[model samples]
Target chain A: MVQPEKARSKIRIYMDILQAVQDDGMAKPTRVLQKANLSHERLTRYLGELVQKNLVKENQDEPGVRYYTMTEQGIRFLQELRKAESFVSGFGFEF
Target chain B: MPFPFLYLDTSFYFLSGIVAFLVSFYAFRYTRLIENSALRFLSIGFTVLGVGLLAEAFIDTLSFFIPSTSSYLLLHRLIIREAAATYSFLQVLAYFVILMGYLLSRRGPASAASSNGSMNRPPTIGFLASATSVVLASRLGELGVLIALAREIIIISSALSMAFLVAIIYLDSTGYLKHRNKQAILVLVGFVLILASQAISFSLGIVAARALGFSEILDFIGTAVQFAAFLSLLLFLIWRGKIGSTGKSAQ
Candidate 1:
């Protein structure tokens, strides 16, 4: 059973992964897992959560291969993050 | 016709070296006053490069004063080329390291960990490209190959960095970014000029090699472009000092 705080952390990770994909274009699960530094065990579960939330979509053009793409919601979330970053940086808070 | 001695004058190198040293000194001093760790690291890096250039200048002067001294001439020739190449490589590495420090300082350790995955990717790619170029140029016995490879690295890195700086400046200038960080703009302009100089010098090198069969004048011009880059860095340091003092007063 995942704790509440851990669940929130996972969501944040999902958001970050989504943002990375959006900025860098489509990535495979293996690539995303490496970049996000998530274990394969954890990535499957987290990616499931993201797909359910419609923040990411996964597809496989061929068998035995999977690619992840950010959804509209993911893009919106990244924009919000950028705005927050700008807001904090403007105050010389250094994020 | 022989190229003018002014093209490789020791006095020119000495003047540029002194200016670079002074700028690095000021950068270090200002960083201490402002208590910015990133700037401090940058200052240290610049100081190293400045000292290297100064030594190169002294070696060149020695060679000029006694051209017939085979030992001095050999030492001078060896030092000038190796020092310049090593310093140029280090300068690129220093920029990447300083940029990493800046990002880490701005974003806390936790944020650094989070951002590291993304941020590290580009530099890693660039390093690979640079290393590959070096190896290939060495194996192929072609200075042009090396120059081309380095040019690609410098161009891509500088262009990306310039874009980021421009965006920051645009935001600040338009009053969207509330903080008045003109230092970024100044540094950006310096980077642009440095990039332009490198591009021009590299192009000239290729042209000279093809047309004039490797003239020393071409070599001097290449080095001159690097000296100009150091001057730009010095000017930015001065600008940074003024900005820091003003910010202090405002506080």
Candidate 2:
């Protein structure tokens, strides 16, 4: 049976990004984009928003090489969203 | 004892209660996961529902085991009546709490912490309901008058709780439409069925019931319908939990 794909929520997208970063240790943007299953344009926009929100921090190891790690706020946000998602989804609710 | 049980039976209420508890258990787990105190109202309601039905079953079972000999028949009836009243009061309370929880959930997280305050707790109502039950249980010689008053109390409380159920069903309908959730639809159906059952019982509460002379019959029908409703919920919740979501995945 083919299940139709549902549109991912913004929070889901954000969490996917955070999760990718969390899994990668210090996440490269390329890897985060792939793991989060987002297009380059969308990833750039979301990552920028995330960094601005202080949920993710950007670091330059050397000159132009950028890596991201989840800020404490980002980790907490992801955890809370995960909890809310599981709970509300069980009831077929819009998280 | 024989008359009431003959109509309502013990198993229906007891079994329905177990279903309510299962639903409540699910809610409780979510509350812990989210660390939200507001959701506790929803869980608490289901727990009370389970307890009330189970208690009714326990009381009925206790009465059944007692000697129904002619000498003890009066005492038996008294006990049965009181137990039924107690169960009714609990039903009223369970519905009330569930309604409150549903409303609070809609209001969202801001209300959650503040709701923990004593003001939200209906301690007086609980005290009055439980106190009435205790009064009935003591088997004081004033059985006739006290039982009549208890019946009125049950009727009024049941009416109030049904109002609560109405509000919940209304909110649920709007919510269900937006979510398109399968299990939620099942729960909504269950609520409607229970409400129908309440209507049947409401008929029994009216003076017309004695004139109709089918209190036992109406009571039985109501219990059976309620039992079926709860059973449906229990079965579906378990079944759906395995299959997982319908792919809606909103909020």
iRMSD in angstroms, per model: 12.3, 6.1
TM-score of the first chain alone, every candidate: 0.71, 0.90
Off by over 4 Å in 2: A1-94, B1-8, B69-71, B109-130, B133-140, B207-213, B244-251
**CAPRI level of candidate 2:** incorrect
lDDT accuracy of residue B54 in candidate 1: 63
Go through the candidates in order and give each one's C-alpha lDDT: 0.51, 0.69
Measured with C-alpha atoms, the lDDT of residue B163 in candidate 1 is 46
lDDT of 1 by residue, A4-42 (tens): 421223334664577557656788887888777788998
In candidate 2, how many clashes are counted? 4
Error of 1 at A74 (Å): 48
B1-251 per-residue lDDT for model 1 (tens digits): 13355336455566666765665465455333333344344445455445545655665555455453644543434334433344344445444544544554454324432442222233244335555666776898865556555444444543443444344334334332334544444444454554554454445434532554354565576567656655665665555444333322111
lDDT per residue (tens digit) for residues A33-60 in model 2: 8899999999999999999999999999
Residue B55 in model 2: lDDT? 76
Top-DockQ structure, candidate number = 2
